[model samples]
Target chain A: MRVGELSRRTGVPVPTIKYYVREGLLPPGELTSPNQASYTDTHERRLRLIRALLDVGGLKVAAIAEVLRAVDDPGRPVHKVLGAATERLGARHAEHDDQEAAEAGAAVGELIERRGWRTDKSSPAAADLARALAAMGRLGHGAFREVLDDYAEAAERVARADLGYVDRKVAVEDLVETTVIGTVLGEAVFNAMRRLAHVDASARLFGTRPEASD
Target chain B: MRVGELSRRTGVPVPTIKYYVREGLLPPGELTSPNQASYTDTHERRLRLIRALLDVGGLKVAAIAEVLRAVDDPGRPVHKVLGAATERLGARHAEHDDQEAAEAGAAVGELIERRGWRTDKSSPAAADLARALAAMGRLGHGAFREVLDDYAEAAERVARADLGYVDRKVAVEDLVETTVIGTVLGEAVFNAMRRLAHVDASARLFGTRPEASD
Candidate 1:
């Protein structure tokens, strides 16, 4: 298979495929001749993964490169790979570190302690939560913090379902790839559904839709 | 209060505040003395909402302006406002409308039907879900559709909790404002918590953390 076929099969442009190779996102294909190289099925699969992460996972190229490095390495611990997979998502909010941030941090600490959740206290997810809460505080919606426990309960169920899917469906060798897909695309799935649910609930409360229109 | 004081209170710069006013995201302050403008509490609150939507909701400035316009108009229906609030988020992925997208749309239709979800069939969230699934299919993880039911169940729980919070905690007058806060920041809250729960679950499976580190 030539690079053109790889591009055709993956629906990625030829130059974009070359750029990925240069970025080390995709390994260079076998160089059978000085000018032309042949790609394989692995190249096609890797290209698809890159597209999925970009289109759905919303990870930056650098973050995808890092996660791919971990996936390609055999000796990396599962926890370390998991950490890499989530690194980019944690910093979506800038940590302002102001008074509101301090208060938000304390609330996150309290929620974790109350839930007895066993995670690194200084984890990125905790920091992400605090930064988000601080943004809310700045907006005068600090009182919305009252529902952290409820959000945590919903998160717990989501996580449990994720674990069950991972444990039952994937082979041990495919852990890193599966983690990236499940974590990133899975988030998109839930966010869209939550919005749909919001519309449904509103229709129920308001009279825009028929009361029994299934 | 003057524009400077409003900026001081909201932590937005004076120039940025003016930009918001110019963008119609914030109502212009009253004409005070030809060259000066006087702002009020409404300006301050609106400024905060604009900042929150930009920072946490990750919505673009244009989307925020549209949502604010919808929010300011009392004649708007609840569903319409929600539709406006979620307008930007639905287009995160390019709607390729390829074969994979076509299949994904069918899957979303099936899920909505199975759940008896009362939503506009042509809603943005459903399209968003289909786009995400199309990306997954491109990655060769179409089998992941098997877990859509599990994801939907968790989403139902989250929607119920959001509705409960919106119902009991807010006044009728504050419905649109509360919906934006809840829909956007609440999204941040759940996403971060879901990541936290992932770390905890991985700890249970891997041995990097103490088995009983409560």
Candidate 2:
């Protein structure tokens, strides 16, 4: 199909698709003529992935480009840390150069050690956790850190389940893209469900309908 | 303290503080003179909260304004859904009026029912879930839908832990702000941890260090 058909089918504009092509987020279509190019099903899938990362994962174009580059690299190994995906998460921020950041970093270190998870504190995900924990301290919600254990346990279970799903359903060739999608869009899925679950818990606690509103 | 002191304390610039004040995200400081205003500790905390929501939660200024409005509403009930916070999440998007949306909506409804959650399908969180699910479908990872059950279970666990944290750590008067922070920033914490856990799981499965890079 042509670019126009690809845009119509995916609900993306032609100009936006061209922009993605220009950005190398989507591969250039095969040239059929001097002025015409033909896209494929692969282009459609890649386009949707780009949009999903932008809209749902809240990732920047530079981050998406990094992850996609990893995906398209034939030599890139699978089942390794998806550094780009982790670095691009919403919680991602550099460790602050201050006492508060130092303390948050220590707390994150302790959580990883206590959880018995074989990981280091310098990973992008750890920096993300440290930054978020530090922000909570600034917000005067430092006591909220008590739930870190529970959250980490839940994270492990979900990660295991996520890996299990990909192991069963995704082929080795598709592992990188599947892992990227599962890591990014999967966060959106879990965030939404967590909010929904909050309503249910609140309904149980307050005895009001979950849809009870202001 | 004065505006300069508040800006210094929170690391927010004077112009940004004025902008937030004009936007009603921060209450105006008390006027001490024609050109100067005195701020309180409350101003400092509110500024930090606003910045955290903007930076960590990835919320728009308009959404932060809405959430802060609810936090200030004296009549807003405690232990109910923090609807504004839910509406402002990164996954947030209007439900599309199309066949794909309808199917995703149905899938989300089924998950809610299966989990025995008390929420309805019309909530902001539900719409977020449906949109994310539809995006996954478009990416040709529709098989990813099979993991919804596991994700929902983990969400419920995390949400319950979140409410418990708030119930114990937050005073009744602070419930609204606490809930909003917990909802928005807590998602960041969980997302980061999940990614961290993914790295650990990958390391274990692939027999490598979790921090192994490209």
Candidate 3:
């Protein structure tokens, strides 16, 4: 297939596809002549994955490039690929050294230790957790830490389900992309459900309909 | 305190504070002279709230304005204020009427009915769920919906805990802002914890250290 057909099939404009190619997010098609290039089924598949990451995962182009690099690297372990993909999901912030952040980091370290988790304290996810806690403390919600255990329990259950789903895949080549999708899009799925549940719970508590206006 | 003092107190720059005033995200300090204005403790608190929404909650200026309007409206119910705040969390996409989106919408509607949730189908959160499911279908991960029940269970548990925390607050004035903080920062906290749990689970399954590089 040619770029035009690829664009038509994917509903992505030709110029955007060219931009993706230029940005190294998508590979260029094979040149059949001076002015014509051919794309393969693999290209179509890659394009769809690219679109999913951009639209649903909300990953930046450079981040997508990094994750795709890990996905395409056959020698990388599946867990490593998964880590690469999940790392991009966190916001990039300069690590804070304030007292609240320090205390929050200590709390995070304790939580990891208590759970017997093997993750490093310096990981971006850990930093994000600490940062969130620090922010909560600043907002006078430091007691929010009391619910951390419940959140952890729920997180563990969801993670187990996620891994179980991923474990059923038979192909090594398919594992990386599948993990990426499950991690990224799965977050979206869970978040939306959480909001729905919140509405349900709030309605029950307040004796109000969910559609009530402000 | 003057604008510069407000800036010094909040760590927000003078110009940024003025910008927020201009954007109506922050109310202007009272004019005391031709060139001087005085802000109050209320200004300091509101400034902090604004920073929390922008930094930790990842809310846009306009969304913050809507939420603040609800917060300032004493006539608004707490749940309504919450709805206003959470409405900004989901992406605002033009609604899709395609087959996959339609099917996903039906699935969302069914899920709501089965769970006895009172939310309208047109709610932003519901629309977000449908959009996510449609994107999953496009990516060949429609089976992700199989875990919807488990996700819902967890969401309910979290939501219950959240409302319980808010219910403990004694001041009616605190309810709306607290709910907003819990909803937004709580999402961040849960997401980070989920990623941490994923790291733990993946490590145990693969016998790899979480800190291992790709």
Candidate 4:
């Protein structure tokens, strides 16, 4: 398949695909001619995985590339790849003084400890936020650690509550991933849902909520 | 107050503050000379607000400018400004043409509805996702709606459970915002908690459970 076909198949665009190719994030398609090339099923699958790492997993291209490299390398431990990706998924800030950033990161860790959260130091989120803070530093921002703390406190409460639902139905890895994804992605998903909820709730109770945001 | 003073107070860098001034996100201070200018309390406050919007709200400078303009213009209804922000947040992905994008956004909206979440559509997060999606589109990637749907379903269950903790203690506004911030920010926090959970649960008689990909 050509770039256009891949685009059609994946719903991605040619220009963006080219950019990905240029970034070395995606393998170049087989050269069929000067202006045309062909892709394969692997390309499609790779593209899907890339999208998942990016859009769903919310990873940067550079980070996604690293993860893919690790996963594709059979010599690398799968748990290490999974561990790295999980760490990347957490709230990350890249711009902070090392002292403050580390302290702030530790603050959240300590809070979790105090709360009796049963987790490990190798958690993906702690790494994710730690990486994010390091990245935010280059962009000339450093308030992310404190901001993350504020965000974390509220999340702690929610996570504690959500555990009650497992009722032994989920496996540990499944439970952990879903819990992490839910806390992180859930905020985005639920906020959207909350908007919809408002509409229905208001319509049912008051006969109207504004049709949309004013 | 000098730039240094403002920097000390807000914890934002002097250069970034200058960047904000150059970008017209912040008004220029009283010019003392070619190399010097003095700020005031107003500047400090504005800087604080700017930091909050960026760090806590996760807004880009350009979008933050628009938000600040709306926030400052008393003639405009707060609701309108908020609505615009929410709309912007909801439309974060502008460039990707993935068929799954729209469905994911809609699914997120629906999941919140099913979970009985109540939030104002005018919240900053509404536009945050929209802007993110727009940037994502430019990258030639797509976030599938089903992935988000699966995420939302899992999140709803977690949120529903989390809600039980704060149901009686917090106001609706606080509950919703806390939940939103928690879900978003806490994803990382809880990952840390769950990393600990994984170790704890693994020690139990159940052993490791299934992974929840779908």
lDDT for each residue of candidate 2 in A10-60, tens digit (9 for 90 to 100): 888999999998998999999999999999999988998898888877788
The model with the greater lDDT, 1 or 2, is 2
TM-score of each: 0.91, 0.94, 0.94, 0.60
Question: Model 1 Cα displacement at B8 (Å)?
Answer: 2.2
| Candidates 3 and 4 compared by lDDT, better number | 3
User: Taking the tens digit of each residue's C-alpha lDDT, what string does model 1 give over B1-214?
Assistant: 9988887777788999888878888888889899999998988888878887787767788878777776777876667766676654564564475888989999999898998888866777888888788888877677878888877877777787777877877887788888888888888788989988888788776645622221
lDDT of 4 by residue, A57-88 (tens): 45578876665554555543323434444444
For model 2, residues B1-214, the per-residue Cα lDDT tens digits are 9988897788888998999999999999889899889999998988889988888777889988877877886764564427665665534543456776787889998988888999877887888888888888777777777888888888889988988987778888778888888887898899889988988888787787754554
Weakest 10 consecutive residues of candidate 3 chain A by summed lDDT: A89-98
Q: Over the stretch A1-214, how does candidate 3's per-residue lDDT look in tens digits? A: 9999998877788999899999988889999999898999888888888887777777779888888887877876666767777887787643446777888999999998988877877887898999888888877788888778888888888888888877764355688888888878888788888888888898899898865553
Worst 10 residues of 3 chain B by lDDT: B88-97
Candidate 2 regions with alpha-carbon error over 4 angstroms: A90-95, A212-214, B79-81, B90-99, B211-214
Candidate 3, residues B1-214: lDDT per residue as tens digits?
A: 9998888877888999999999998888899999898999988888878887777766778888887887787876666767876776777653446777888888899898988887877888888888888887877777777777777778888888888877774367788788778877888889888898998899999998865553
Regions more than 4 Å wrong, model 4: A30-37, A51-59, A75-78, A89-107, A121-124, A127-211, B8-13, B31-36, B48-58, B75-82, B94-214
TM-score of 2: 0.94
Clashing pairs in 2: none
Candidate 1 chain A minimal-lDDT segment of 10 residues:
A205-214
lDDT score, candidate 4, position B121? 35
How much DockQ does model 4 earn?
0.19
> Per-residue lDDT for A178 in model 3?
85
Write down the C-alpha DockQ for each prediction.
0.54, 0.70, 0.65, 0.19
Model 1, native contacts kept: 0.65
